[model samples]
Structures are given as structure tokens and as C-alpha cells.
Target: MLSHLPTNHHLRPLYRLLALASGVYVLVFGIIGVVQTSGAETFDRSGDATALGLPTNPAFAYASVAVGALIVLSALIGRNLDFYVYSVVGLVFQIVGMLALAFLGTDVNYFNFSVATCVVSLVIGLALFTAGLYSRVGARADAH
Candidate 1:
């Protein structure tokens, strides 16, 4: 998948910027998650206002931190769409989890899953998804 990354593209900078921005966003949010609610009686699934969805708390917070780390790491190593898959995976998870949180709700924990939470997740999912897909470098016209 990393066989051929475009040498140049107008959107490359924007792509990298988005990647970095999103990466930092999640990274910081995830850190806050673990630090803020580590020993709380219940989970805390709220934050990431930058679309941000910056979700967090306890076991879930650790999960976010891991995912956030991957996102940040990918921005460093993911020079192309192939590496951007990490971002895609993380965003998709947020989208799915938030959607479920919005509708079905979690019985496993009493986290406050509200409509706003769903919106945040969905927004972040779309944002990262867009960035990942947009960054894809296609085969060159002369690569045939």
C-alpha cells in the first residue's frame, strides 16, 4: 500500500495539517480522560469539542489514549493513505460508539451518553475520514 506516494499535491499540506491537528486533539483529550476520571466512581464520556469528540474515562479513557496515540503516531509515519488507516479506524470507533451511546445507551456503565455526544463523535468521524481519504495519493499518470 505504501508503494507509491505522490511527490507533490496542493492539498498535501492541508492533509498533514489536519492529521496533526486531529492527532493532537485526540492525544490531549485522551490524556485528560485518564487523568481526570481515573478513579471516579463512574465513567466520563464527554469532551472533544473540536468535532473533537475528545471522549474519555477509566478503561474507556485508556482506550482513547491508545487510539489517540495511534492517530498521532500515524501523522508522523503515515505519509500516505495506507498509514492513514489508523486514523480511519480510530474515527470509526468513535462514530460507532457515540452512535450507540446516543441511541441504545450502555448498560455496562452509567456514562452520560447524550445527543451532543453522538454529534461530536459523528463530526470527528467525518472529519478524520475526510482527511484520510483526501490524503490518498493516486497512481501517477505515467505509472502504467
Candidate 2:
């Protein structure tokens, strides 16, 4: 069933670049978030902190930095390692986005995520998933 997915796709480089760009974007966002939320409570729910125009808190900002770094590292390491990294991160982003969306404006919004953040997360997740799908490498015999 998974045979339909392309391996060593012609546009793999482009997809990889997009994924890298996404990681960089997230990294920058997290850095700015950390700076913006400095001295604030780790899980502050004041709903007033924001970074790169998205709501955030210390905990979320730190997590973003870690996740972004992981993505960046995996993308740089390539050789199909990125494929697994992107796939897992993509799913994680999707799940986090949904959970944040569901908990918005409530006490459980641990990430202090706003609607914009949720949208961004979902978009990034999709981009990473697509990149992973086309970034696979196969033996010479399986090349198309």
C-alpha cells in the first residue's frame, strides 16, 4: 500500500530545503519566545505573552526550541534519518496543535497557544509530513 510513495524523488532536495526552512523558522520563533517570556512563570497562563505574534510561555518556548533543533539536526543529517524525524515530528505537531486548539481559552492551555499558533503548528506539521513523504531514499534498484 505504501508503494505509491515516491523514493528518491526528483524534488527531494526542494522538499528537504522546505523542511529545513520550517525548522529554522520554528527555531527563531522559539528563541524570540524565550526572550519575550523571560522571567515569566514556566507555565504562565496570563495569556499575555507572545512571540513572533503567537502566544507562548516559558515551557512552550523551551519545548519549541528543543523540537526545532531536533528537526534542524535531522534534516541536516539526511540519509533517511530526516524521514523518520520529520514523520514523528509531523505527527507530534498535528497532535499538539489539536490539543492546544481544544484547550484554548481554558485552564488547561499549558502552552498558552492561541488560534494563530494552532494554525501555524498545523501548517508546519503538513509541510514536514510532505517533506518526509518525498525525502525517502532507496537502493539503486528501487530508484525511479
Per-residue lDDT for 86 in model 1? 42
Off by over 4 Å in 2: none
List all candidate RMSDs to the true structure. 5.0, 1.2
Output the TM-score of candidate 2: 0.95
Residue pairs whose backbone atoms clash in candidate 1? 48-52, 48-53, 48-54
lDDT of 2 by residue, 1-144 (tens): 457778889899999999999999999999998999999999998878888888889999999899999999999999999999998899889998999899997898888888999999999999999998889899877875
Q: Each prediction's Cα lDDT score? A: 0.58, 0.91
lDDT of 1 by residue, 1-144 (tens): 534543445576687677667667666766776676756544544433222353444655566577677777777775464246645664785667565674545554333445655565566666676566556554566233
The top-ranked prediction according to TM-score is 2
Residue 128 lDDT in candidate 1:
71
TM-score of each: 0.67, 0.95
